[model samples]
Target: MNPDEDIKGMFDCCFTIFYQLKGFGEEILEDKLVHKLIYLLPESWESKKIAIIEAKDLKKLKLDELIGSLLTYELMSKRLIREKGKKIKEQGIDINIIALKSSKKHQEDSSEEGSEDEEMVYLFKNFARFMKSEKERSKH
Candidate 1:
């Protein structure tokens, strides 16, 4: 398969999995199965893929950085859930709560820090001021 096609295919699969799980209940999103599907998506898909995943904590995320962080969190959540499930299955007990706690922590850690827009805003303001100053000088 072509490199780009493969990435698109993987992203489509993840999208399908997310929609399918959504039918069962939002709780399925918290399940390890969904997380694994999300993890299967390529790192390059992180920006586009993040827009599809449902995250409660994403409210504070900046639009520009949200996509990448969301993808990273999705991948981490899936891995953590998979490992937790494997251990529980072997030990004959469910550690869903523990998995959730750890996944939340990882998500928080993976989320992008600071706002890029703030710097852009400062730069824009400076440029505008410079343009206004130039206009005044030209009038003189």
Candidate 2:
């Protein structure tokens, strides 16, 4: 299999495990989750895999922390791939400096929009409770 395929497989495995475990009412033990995550990691992450395995307090690590690390790694890997692709495309061509700036601006805008959407969702979930409490206070 090619390197891209291997990376995709690793991402799929990690996301699947996260989705399965994240919904449970009880917390998954750190040791078991860590072992599973380490085992699921591809050889490309050799340094990280080694570091996680050799950590003195692997058992004490939280599941959320592990998941966050894995997610960040995945995002970084994807960004690197995108940058590499951009570099390849730029070769043997007159790169448009303005286009590059616009592309970066677009990425930043999209990220900000994502944060705003998350904030809206949080408010939507809590707004009803807040209104109910306000009504009770007004009656009392």
Candidate 3:
């Protein structure tokens, strides 16, 4: 798979989820899913959409929802890496598990025990690093 396609897929998946959540109800814009979508997004794209989404005050979204989304995306990314490992190995390619682990570990390290917002904030800050690493792996 091309790196561009993979990045586009990630963007499309999160955007679709975000849009659906946005249309669900008045408070749906404040959903943790929205935060996770924002968190997973690359810095390149965040600036364009974040202003629109952040215009809504969603500070009241429960901690459980926020953390849940973070964990869900983490698990999904891990599973993708694991599944792709087999194909890379079969092709005798150098696998970059370090990058994947670093991305996930960064999430775990940054997330505080009592807050999801903090974790999301951390993710937003590191989005560029994560995207670069994933793109490299996909190219190999």
Candidate 2 Cα outliers beyond 4 Å, as residue runs:
1-28, 93-140
**Which structure among the candidates has the greatest lDDT?**
2
TM-score of each: 0.24, 0.44, 0.29
For model 2, how does the per-residue alpha-carbon lDDT over 39-138 read when each residue is reduced to its tens digit?
7676777787787667646778776776677677778888998997798687744455758877888787997878899999999879988999999999
Evaluated at residue 100, the lDDT of candidate 1 is 83
Screening candidate 3 with a backbone cut-off below 3 angstroms (N, C-alpha, C), the clashing residue pairs are none
lDDT: worst 10-residue window of model 2: 1-10
Cα lDDT over the full model 1: 0.60
**For every candidate, C-alpha RMSD to the true structure in Å:** 18.1, 14.6, 19.1
Which candidate number would show the highest TM-score if scored against the true structure? 2
Question: What is the overall TM-score of model 2 with all chains considered together?
Answer: 0.44
In terms of lDDT, model 3 sits at 0.61
Better of 1 and 2 by lDDT: 2
Estimate, for each residue in 1-140, the C-alpha lDDT of model 1 and write its tens digit. Answer: 12455433555666687777787775442345435544555676565457556553333444335335554665776699799779889987555577887778676865442245567788999999999999999999
Candidate 3 lDDT over 1-140, as tens digits, reads 12344444665666676677668853444465555555665654455346535654546655355445545655677699888988878877565575786778777877453367777788987997899999999999
How well does candidate 2 score on lDDT at residue 108? 78
